[model samples]
Target: MRAHGDFSRTADRTPGMTVLTVDLVHHPAHSVLTLHGELDFASSDRVPPLIDAVVKAGRRRLVVDTVGLTFCDSRGLRALIHAERALAALGGGMELVNVHGRLLRLLDITGLTGVLAITTGPGAGQAVRK
Candidate 1:
């Protein structure tokens, strides 16, 4: 996963402060990319490269796991929309998992709840192991 506009490095150059941790993960299944992160301005820029890489990798379906995300801003929401559009252009699709709290509310308020497929809780759509 590529991290763009990471303030962690800039913070290091300054001083005094300790450190802020931003974690991101990309789980590519058959044709999906599951993401877990804060999804704020600090990490929003990272979404594009991930999408690009996935497209280049020839994946069609994208599933984003938002279960671990604690927060998200408008920019972050836009990133998801942009990803969906990009995938659509390639005749692919995207889905979101573990939507809850502020993230769910944001989607509702922005009228995206109906536009995106959102699964909730731990067992919303778990895959069975063989």
Candidate 2:
């Protein structure tokens, strides 16, 4: 299978916060985005456009790994929700993986734990063979 990722070095400054750095893997079945840094008002706006571009290209399922993600505000959550809805409308879905600590709680409090197609890991949602 063919897959691609967007990796970057160095930080881009925008006013007070550094922009969220996203590493994306575009695959035939799905797109995997490994997000680093913070997703707040300053950088949360960076996500949807990218997700839209992916969706527009016909990739449906989206798996977002929040392992490297540090901080996320309301704006970030909004961006995620928008992407989820965008994908849902296309008959696709979104998943969250490697979530822990406050981020997990945040998703629960915001009710995204139910909204997002969450998994324990990349393969957790898949049925295991004995």
lDDT of 1 by residue, 1-130 (tens): 4332332344433354322233333345424444444566656777777788777766766777666577788988999999898988888878787788889999999999888878876675352110
Q: Measured by TM-score, how close is model 2 to the native structure?
A: 0.77
> Against the hidden reference, what TM-scores do the models get?
0.73, 0.77
Which lDDT tens digits does candidate 2 get at residues 4-84? Answer: 333322265445644467866677678777787787776777787778767766788888888777878898899889988
Cα deviation in Å at residue 44, candidate 2? 1.0
Clashing pairs in 2: none
**What C-alpha lDDT do the candidate models reach, one value each?**
0.66, 0.73
For candidate 2, what is the lDDT?
0.73
Q: What is the C-alpha RMSD of each candidate to the true structure, in Å?
A: 4.8, 4.6
